[model samples]
Target: MTARNQGGCDGEHVCRIVDRAGEHFPGSRGKGLTARTQEVLDDLGVVDEVLHFGFRHLPHRRYLDGDQVAEADPHAQRTPTPDRPYDGGLLIPQWRIERILRTRLAEHGVRVELAAGLAEFSQSANGVHAVLDTGERVAARYMVGCDGGRSTVRKALGVRFEGETKEQAMLLGDVELSGLEPDAWYQWTVRGRGFLALCPFRHERSWQLQAVPFSDLGAEGSFPEPSLPYFRRIVDDLAGGNGIRLSKASWLSTYRVNVRMADRFRVGRVLLAGDAAHVHPPAGGLGMNTGIQDAYNLGWKLAMVCSGARQSLLDSYQEERLPVAAWTLGVSAEGLPRVAERFVNGGSTDIADGAPSDGQQLELGYPASSLSVGGDAESGPRAGDRAPDAPCVDSSGTLRRLFDAFRGPHFTLLGFGESCAGPLRDVGTAQRGLVKPVWVGAPGSGADLVDVEGHARTAYGVTGDTLVLVRPDGYLALRAPGASRTAVRDYLDRVGVSRSA
Candidate 1:
């Protein structure tokens, strides 16, 4: 991976590899013993490192238009249910997130080469050959371009980036403020002029400032260089002597909003992911989250194919992700105007209210992918939907969550109700290493799990015998009513994993 930034989805990929290896290579632990290496690996065992600084719930959003308050939505104050631990989105700085991921990658003996980049590459029928900027030659079965919007790999593949750049540019910067609460979001909009927003960064004494100047202030159809003085003027104009003052400045930039995506995610053996694949406004905070998800979706599929799954499986990356990117683009675009309108007219701000659920990203799924197969259309989560998490009791009488069972790289076969027992056991025996089977029955029935309070059954939409095969990325691959072993077997075979017996 030729990553310009060593965090975000790149870090996530490294963590996923470590998790998978732990499950599959349990016996190989400490075989090649090195004291230092073991220590690093031990540190990487912190499974929650990915969400180390994440918020328990979304932060409250407050909207202000000049001195007048327009709306305040404390959506993040909602209590989290057992099934849904994260009630809203998390707010963590990108740099810090990258640091945590880098630490994990180091444990796995993967070091990111800073200042190094992909110089050139070519692909044949079998694999891809790449030359790094250091003149190092490397051959691999595949190459992924997670290299931001100005991806060299995507350009080399001649993929068209289809989208338009907004005529108006916005000024963004990080600075210290003399007066402002660090708990809520603040914004000011002058009707038909422009808008200014200041949100508290997670870091102390720092804030993210965004300004869109009114057309009359020479902001429309042109770009302006960002400077400390320029930012101060905008803050003064927007705040109108509200005791808010910019004390010190750190980083600044001028950005033109561009919403575009590659015409194709894959061109032969090279694939596009993250900003290389799509770029849109950060209206719904979708940028980083979407990219991380794109990596998660592609990682397991790539692993499967490299281990003898069909090459055709790679095609589904585009099929499943392209539409999602397009839809996300539309959502963010639609939200921009709504937010601007709220700043201008002082009506109820849909952007603030909708963000809790809209930005949670729990609704994203791959229902139309070739890998998703058979389930009742009218009831329950479809084959392509996200597998909902639920609380349950393990066979050992310990409490566990569905997410715990789905943590590893292998497929999860969930058999709900008593009727599913025989087929579930048979499928478990047949699939062995590739599938981990869990029989969910009533409490005290001696199943692998006892669905106490019927949480699992309710969350899974299973009233009777049902078998759900969840993919490595926590999406349903197949849902067979009546616990049909044939359906499970056929779906597995189609995905290039055969039954052992």
Candidate 2:
């Protein structure tokens, strides 16, 4: 989804996206939305719309051989805090998520060209020439492949797709069915009957069905088309029908446990992102979220390069994101078998038994990247960690979040003492659109932002004045002593943020 259509880049750089698919398919995939994704949506200004339609907590109501057996949650739910307004994975169908994001992109004048996928592309020192599947040759400054695990761009680049696909597979679909409670996730694990679960979608009569039959269903890339009759038969055999009737289906697809990643994220001027770069097992819902993060991480950097930043800044995309993808592959791989074992042989509700509690990837960062530097505190977030959000008070007695200060397509510099005001102001004035500076001090100490409750200090682990520079994507790029505006200016120079040119 990263800048794949006309004017797709985050800012004004002309961008375009081509979806291989003919249209948006209504599929209920990726049941959990982590807080990190929420933060990205927040940064994009679509978090409120996503929250309006998504849910956080729902108990999985389990059954055995046509009898209601138990009810338990899939994972632990956390309450929203000031520092982490989005607490846990949200339950929004992948289709709705796409629509929300698509709408937001459209708001920015992005034009998504559907059914026009990349057939082949060639790049030179300056730009790329892309031949779409539609036989249209388009020229662009750069090219990014966000297609999927079976990415044409990846294949064209001859990049090796590394990893294995498990024999385990599942049937996924959204069907309009009646005769069951629409609120709970109904699961049936019948001996020899196979495992089946029906989860209701929000504000829609259709429920998403996840089923695993005992038979292998002719594995190895061969499977029957997802049909309503096949689903009804499964419901009859495995679920004992339960009087639930499927009127029709909106979307249907089969999922295999594939854990794979590209050997390289970029080749020449053509770049790979999302599933094109990596694909994960269904175990932790890491597939979609990891891809989204890849796009988010690349978006700002790509925009910068497009806007004349150092070309080396583009190198950091893979340098930083490839490791995250590798880590995600490992995590998803470790959790998949446990999840499959439980789904096939039901026991506990924590199907993701060994998955990281940081499911939302809030703790995710690029600590080792060239972009991260200068945080020496042992207890607080170091460079490359997400800049913690804190609620601070303004002079008007208004409450403002650190996120509020961090929003928009700009670097943010926060100085936590009075002494930093002068230099911070100077930088803000010089790099007005690139970096926004906010000074925090006691109410009467005359700072741009006032921290009366010490929330900022608590969240950031600051005992005294400190200077923190956050990148456009909200990761702490640099954290140093408050007086070292020189370090700030140096980093700006390194990243090539032109001073209001």
Candidate 3:
């Protein structure tokens, strides 16, 4: 392919595509964007290039139009969702994102060079240098360390990862089983000795199982790899050797739990994300999700900073994400021990509280920083509110997600129907660069039209007609039930946005 300027309606800077296309590129998974997020990227003009590779091809069909596309294909089944219950372990979205990334990154002009391991990394005031296993050195303006708990970059930076490793070990394996309860996750315990959890993956033929042995029960004081016999023994302990039978096994691995967080996410131009910065026991299946969110949060900020945002804007990344990671690590640390205790003390089978905790749920707000909009005066979870997606209507009389129009780098103002918030709509859109107003509800609904379901209403805590300004990272900036342009302007200026408009 040739270098080309793919201009947009806005102008030449909208997007550009210039790179090699086809087979030369290699694709690596385990961390990539999903189809839904990819569509968002396309809409934002963040990626404007395509290069397909061998054994990597688009599915040629959309999966989200209420269709079960994955059920029809063997390969597609590898990506599973909560909608489909499995007798085995569930295939979380993080894994699905990985599958898509393996294909999409190459399509988006990322040259994936694999099989070559990293040997060393060196950093200077100029930039960071990575020496690959093949003796190739790659240099970049900045290097992000997304490489799991044992980060090579973090080591190269001479930073020590602070945390304790657990002696309790878990044996995990994916197996094919039948005659088991279908469509739900299963957990059973042997009354203070061991506990077993079974989750279904994508295919009916496979499932992931985790078995935790009680103290000093194993030969080496660690849960070792389980053969067919050993697995059956644990199954019998949990299920009394009935109700489920297993035959085939896929992948088996052993993991030692650890809870740790790095001192600083940023060391000069090199930064850390995901497990590299914080590692926690996998109680809520959040290790991967948190890591992915870290990448997503950092991805756009890095892009904006590199493209020309205030340098202070870049510093806010650590300020914003570190708290979230800290909260996640704390919650996980609190949860796993409780879970272990419950299993040991007769397997109570009580569910962990799924309701969002103050620290667990909110889109951590940054105070005393360039990105913060609201002042530190507010109490409760107001300072750090996760931006809520609502059912809303567009100007053309079509229903749309509140998050849809609010995409890209801008503050989104959701004008809840016209009655109560009609005045807010006018005030919000009039603010220009600082605010982008979007009207929700039908054409003639009163300014305070509230059509959200119970779940959304409960999540957002919306009482009546309101104006909710969502920040770029999907956090509530300023919220008011009534319209007030003066209030909006004051908040924007506080956040460092110019108020010339």
Which candidate number maximizes TM-score? 2
> Which regions of candidate 3 deviate over 4 angstroms?
1-94, 101-107, 202-204, 215-221, 351-370, 376-383, 413-469, 478-501
lDDT on C-alpha atoms for all candidate structures = 0.68, 0.80, 0.54
lDDT against true structure, model 3? 0.54
Flag regions of model 2 displaced more than 4 Å.
1-12, 74-77, 219-223, 352-354, 498-501
lDDT of 3 at 497: 48
Local error of candidate 3 at residue 357 (angstroms): 4.3
Clashing pairs in 1: 193-214
For all predicted structures, in order, the TM-scores are 0.85, 0.94, 0.69
lDDT of 3 by residue, 134-247 (tens): 786666546777667888767777777888887667777777788765454566666555667665533335666777766435654476456766776777666664457778
Report how far off residue 132 is in candidate 3 (Å). 2.1
> What is the lDDT, from 0 to 100, of the residue 219 in candidate 3?
55
Q: Output the worst ten-in-a-row residue range by lDDT, candidate 3.
A: 49-58
Number of colliding residue pairs in each model = 1, 8, 12
Supply the TM-score for candidate 3. 0.69
**After superposition, candidate 1 runs with Cα above 4 Å error:** 1-52, 55-65, 74-78, 191-193, 215-220, 345-358, 499-501
RMSD of each: 8.4, 2.4, 10.2
Error of 3 at 437 (Å): 4.7
Number of the candidate with higher lDDT, 1 or 2: 2
